[model samples]
Target: MDSLRADAYLQHIGVPRPGTAGAAELRALHLGHQLVVPFENLSIHLGQDVPLREEALVEKIVDAGRGGFCYELNGAFGGLLAALGYEVTLMAARVFGEGGRLGPPYDHLALRVAAADGSGPWLADVGFGRHSHFPLLFDSRGEQSDPAGVFRLVETPEGDLDVLRDDAPQYRLERRPRQLADFEATCWWQRTSPKSHFRQSLVCSRLTEDGRVTLSGRTLVVTGSDGRQERELPEHEVLDAYRDHFSIVLDREPQVAPLDA
Candidate 1:
C-alpha cells in the first residue's frame, strides 16, 4: 500500500496517523474500523466476485466506501498496518460451528500484529462481528475483558489456540502464518457453494456508539442500551437503509439467494 492510500484508509476509518505505531494506536485503529466498516456479505448475493488480493480489497473497502466479510476486512486492515510499519502476519482459523464441529480449513482470517514499540503481538481482528472491541493479547492465557464480553485464549494439546467468548468457543486459530492467497479456495467456497451460509443470507451490519444496527434481508434490526428493535423494510426503503445506516450507496438492494441454489 502506498502512503497516499494509507492516509485515505485512515481517514475512511476516522483515525489519525500516529507518529508511532504502538499499542494505543492499534487499539484506536481496531475500534475505528469496526465502527465504520461494516461486516457485510452482500457481494455474494449481488453476483459480484470477491477477490482476496490486497489491491482489490483496498479498492473495495477504501475507494468504494464498502465493507466485506473476514477476508476483505482483515486483508485490507492488515495491509494498512504493514504500510504503517507494524509487523502484520495473516493467520488462518477454523470457525467452530454447532455441535462443536469445526468449519473447513481457512474458514476465517485473522491477524497477529506487533507494534513498533515492541509492546505486543496482539490478536487484531476487526472482521469478526460482535467480537472484542480491541485486540486481545496474543500471549495471554488469562481472561481478557472488553465491553462486548469476556474473552480467553485456551491453548490446546495440539498447540492451536481456541478463542472463547463469554466461555463459549468461537474458533480454533492455527499459529502458522498464512498469505492472502492461501484463503482463495475457501473464499470461493463461501461465495459459490449453496451450503455456505454466506450464500444463503443477505446481511450488512456495523457497530454503533450505543450498540449495533443490521439489515438482514428486508429486516432492519437495531440493538442498543435501551433494547433491541426490529422491523422489516419496504423494498423501496432498502437502498436508503444501506446508505443511511452503513454509508453504503447501492444501485439496488441485494436479495437472498435460494437455499437450494
Candidate 2:
C-alpha cells in the first residue's frame, strides 16, 4: 500500500496526520473523516450493485471519491486505519430491521481497536449513520459520554454486551472479532432487498465535535451541543440539503417523500 496516498486522504478529509497512533488522535481523525466523507447508497439507485469485496470498497471510496454504507465504509476505513498503524478488528452487529424485528448476522460492520497502552480493546465506529462522536471503552461496564450521545456496554445474560446510546439499546455486541468478508450476505441483502432500511430510505448522518446531524428521507435535521431542530423540506430542497449540509453533490437527485408519504 502506498503510504503517500493514504496520508493524502488524511489531508483530504482534514484529519491531522499524527504519525503515532494515540487514542485521541485516532478519534479525531475518524470523527473528522466521517463528517467530511458521507456514507451513501446512490449506486444502488444508479442500477449499480455494491460489491462485498474489499478492493471494490477501496476503489469506490479511496479511489473513485465516493462513500458507502457499513460494509464498504467499515471495510475501507479499517484498511486505512491498519495502514495508519492502528490495529483494527471487524465485528458484526445484527441491525434493528424495521417493525422492531432483529435481523441476521453481518447486518452491520463495526470496529474494535486496541488501546494505546494495550488495555484491552475500544469500540470505534463512524459508519453507524448515527452513533457516538467519539470512541467508547470496550471494557467499560458503565456509561461513556461523547459529543453525539451517551454510550455504555452492558453485559447480557448470554454474556454478550449490549451497546446503548443515550440509554437507547443500539446493537448487542458480540465479543468475537471478525473479518470483513464475513458480512458479504448481509451486504447483499441491504443493497438488494426492500425489507432492508438502507434500501428503503436515503439516510446520511455523522457526528461532529460538538453534536450530530442527520438527513433522513425528505427531512433535514441538525442537532448541536445545545439543541435539536427538525424541518420539513420540499423534494427539491432535499437535494440542496444533501449538497450544502452533507457535502455531497448528487448527479441524480433523490425524489424524497415524507416518511408517511
TM-scores, one per candidate = 0.98, 0.86
**Ten consecutive residues with minimal summed lDDT in candidate 2?**
252-261
**Which ranges in model 1 have alpha carbons more than 4 Å from their true place?**
none
Query: Model 1, range 66-166, lDDT digits (tens) per residue?
Result: 99999999999999999999999999999988899999999999999999999878999998888999999999999999988999999999999999999
C-alpha lDDT of candidate 2 relative to the true structure: 0.74
